[model samples]
Target: MAISASVSLVMTLAFLLASCGGMGTHRGTPLELTIAHINDHHSHLEALPDQIVRIGGVDTQVELGGFTRLASAFRSYEGRDNVLRLHAGDASTGTLYYTLFKGRADADMMNTICFDAMAVGNHEFDDGDAQLKSFIEQLHTGPCKTPVLSANVHPQRGTPLAPQNAEDYIQPYAIKNIRGIPVGIIGITIKRKTQDSSSPLPSTSFEDETSAAQRTIDQLKARGIRHIVLLTHQGYQADKAMATKLSDVDVIIGGDSHTLLGNFSKQRHLPKSAGPYPTRVANRDGKPVCVGQAWEFSKAMGEMNVSFNAEGDVTSCTGQASLIIGDRFKRKDAAGKWVAVDPATPQKIAAEAATDASLKMLAEDAIASNVLRSYSSQTEKMQKESIGEASQALCLVRTPGESFNASGEVAGCEEANQRAHGSDVTQLVAQSFLRTSLRADLALHNAGGVRIPVPAGAITLGQAFALMPFNNVLIELPVTGEQIIAVLEDAVSSYLDAGRSSGGGHPYAAGLRWHLDMSQPKGRRFSRLETKDRQSGTWASLDPARTYIVATHEFLARGQGGYASFKPIYDSGNYVNTHFLYTQAFVDYVRAHGKVQRPAPADYSHQAVTTQAGVVLH
Candidate 1:
């Protein structure tokens, strides 16, 4: 009584079909399935530079990623047997494309890529609930509509947190048939408690992932579906723990952790199987459970091939996580259509690509492209190209003191400079978009939000966009003299005293400067606070009682980056997306002044004050 190959395939397919209520099956005949996935794209709609990414000791050049190339690759996967295209999360934010388009272009790009489904990452809420709803609306109404799933989000008691028009656009779980095999897909969102408060999820909350996943798994089991797949926005550690606890789950397609799982490894509590498996650990059901993820951006696509038995459980699987590099070559057809040839081949790269071509093209054209280009063209048309020049050179450098400061003051200082550029750049572009609608003001950016440094050169619109990638709204909040001191104290205690150094150290100030006494207790670090109104030209004491309209990134006003005290003073009325606003401001400033100058040495002065710890010094 030997099992025939066709019989086994038929049984597996039957089980899979039964699991999904006979909705659909894979396109191929071999009964083989391949899942191609990307995560944390963050709207990096460009082809990046090539770089060496070391994976399994094989060094290769990965030319980086672009949405256009990704679309081509995804289309190639179509008409193939058992191919699934998906994204893990963080599809919006972190790049210029998102900043200029407010996620509309990214959504279009995703539609072109034909993503089957995506989990909701934390950054999806960076624009807040209202914007998120709008994005959902667009996706629902768009031509290339895909399912979005999240089991953890709970609506508020009164308000319609989930949009009515987009209800069908989102689901907690989906069951699909792949090559006659029933596969259950479950989506999970990140817990808001662990994320920064700046996430734009008002009146909504997240549930416990493990509990929510357990319920979904049980529901799928009741439906007779056994081949389970989890599309999760939770990070790697959480995924590992969930796998250990939830034995019924077969495969966990994860994001948010951004770990490069080049090959399948064994699970902790799972057992050894009779054949080769993707993971080291086996589940209680004796099925080989696998976990996979593709790092942020469309830099790479993850592929996993799994083989199941008559029971519809994964038995053995072999696959490699492949990174897709974007390369374009111009060629002519017989009829002379001037087609764009894609040079992306599935090769093992030693490093990821550094350049993003899609972004570069957008920069060069600045109009025909998506939102950023449109904004740039508008700015140029209005002759808004320059902002106030640097009085002196402000370059990001790491000093030794950065290692010792509580807030990583040195790092904070350097990052502040970086963020100033990022914020200024984003603000300039955003301002350009809304030139006719709103009046521009001094661009203010939070040091904590700046993730990278601004390279010195003829700063392109793209360069500024990379620095201030988060599409945070600009907020003009009025804080009394007492609130101002409280905010400064919060910055010192959380940033200076608390040893969390980002970038270099020391918080960078664009239009303000002050001296701090580190030895003083947490709330008493700022010994002197001063601000120079660009108009006044003279340093003025920050009155504790008088309210002043301060421009800041929305993240800071919402008490993100450890500045919880400022939350109370957050003014929702004056909030606007600074992406176009600031860019326009910079363009106007630069055009008016021709060549800008960095601030002079005298513009910024600092001295460490003595405290109980010692004569604090930097």
Candidate 2:
């Protein structure tokens, strides 16, 4: 009887152990939550580089980053006591994949990866509000269930923030229960008004980021949520400012900046204090905080492991940002021979083991898939397509101090001129169009407007579309010759400042070449300025009183390129879509002359030029 009774007791204890994770004091211990995160995927669905990374002194080989490989990794962590998968933002742009599918394939892939929540990036609005609404509908109605959250965006007067599923579309915050501890997440986006005009953000207003975050944090605290994570589309400096100002925030998983934080040491800037304050401040409950972010694309995943006490306060934390390199990749060495290798463990491993067959198959599939073939295939299928031709092979490369007039000079012209524009490829195209269409004295376009390099080959209609993606119209403005000189001086100053120049040493211009003094303040860079008339073929001194017709893109004419002085230059009636004109010109030129000759530099005389205190050039 005693032996039988003991067996029954043992059976009952075993049942309890299996049901409640093995009894004792372990039941009350705070759960360990592991969060795996990535941000700014930007439609890179292919497997990235796989490398062995060192995290907290532990070397672990991360082999893949495709949605499938990420799926496998998620499955491995499934059934763990606590785990969450998340992405920061900016998953909607940057590649042929995004351009083709308009974020459908990306949504499907992200759904497969099982993302719990995502912040809306500025690019999410690139296709306009209606498309963004459709994307939201697909996410909500699709097989995968996840919430797209943005706290600051408020719809303009008539447009709805979200017409369908308006109730469940977005929330200021979400609370997740992990082992009896509640984790609160707050989502915010950068103010769209401050963004570049190229971004297709709706006319809706976005609240100030810092204020919005503080209000949300206060609300979360009111609900008794102690642990907070801010999922923000604001850039790195903004995130740091939020972290320092708001002590309630526990961890900031941010995007938009595309910053890579590989380890905790790389995140030394966190726990920063505000202003003159030295010591790190604490939340209302008094807890230290951490901030982290992953670089853009599927190139990496960020992992942060934090231990909290019974009070739901973080005690210790370790972070690792793992880079995802594709498998079976062969890199050339100094001798230029392809060799089998492991980037992490370079010494010894089987050649077969080094190659990941699955990843290789994926790369092959991406290349073979029709979706990846051209960036416009899917886009054209969705909208009414138009056919156009290119007259000139629009080349996108620009050399420093090069101007648009170089094209005319290259075609052979003398030093006689009446306007000042620099030599650059885009400037050349703009100048050619101005002279051919409107007979303008000077032509101008913002350096930022020219996006990609127009490859010297068969210029497809789609290629032209991509080159001038932004639908901006051309406008002719009337400005004094002095104002034109001022604009040229600004461009020259930008050329000398390594940080300000967009195309490295290259600063775009249309008419003239003048020496710049790097040592002086920006406005004083020009030491010599001269121009030549196109028809007269004789050199002329610039008449400060003469009103010159300047052709420029609409954005610059509106004073966007830091050229506030140009705002006073009123626009003339000869306005046309710059893209349309360029397309027509390119098509005509290409059709007429099978080959487009490259523009060469012009020889112009500038007398002795010198800067303040005798910094001279001849």
Which one is best on lDDT? 1
Cα lDDT, all candidates: 0.56, 0.54
Residues 538-600, model 2: lDDT tens digits: 546667789776666665565544444565653434334344344344345444555444444
How good is model 2 by TM-score?
0.63
Per residue, candidate 1 scores C-alpha lDDT tens digits across 5-121 of 889998998888768665344322233557778898877776655333333333333345666666665676767868778788888776666776787777766766667778878
The TM-score measured for candidate 1 stands at 0.63
Clashes of each: 87, 35
Model 2's alpha-carbon lDDT is 0.54
How well does each candidate superpose onto the true structure, as a TM-score?
Answer: 0.63, 0.63
Error of 1 at 561 (Å): 5.4
RMSD of each: 10.8, 11.7
- Model 1 residue 255 lDDT? 83
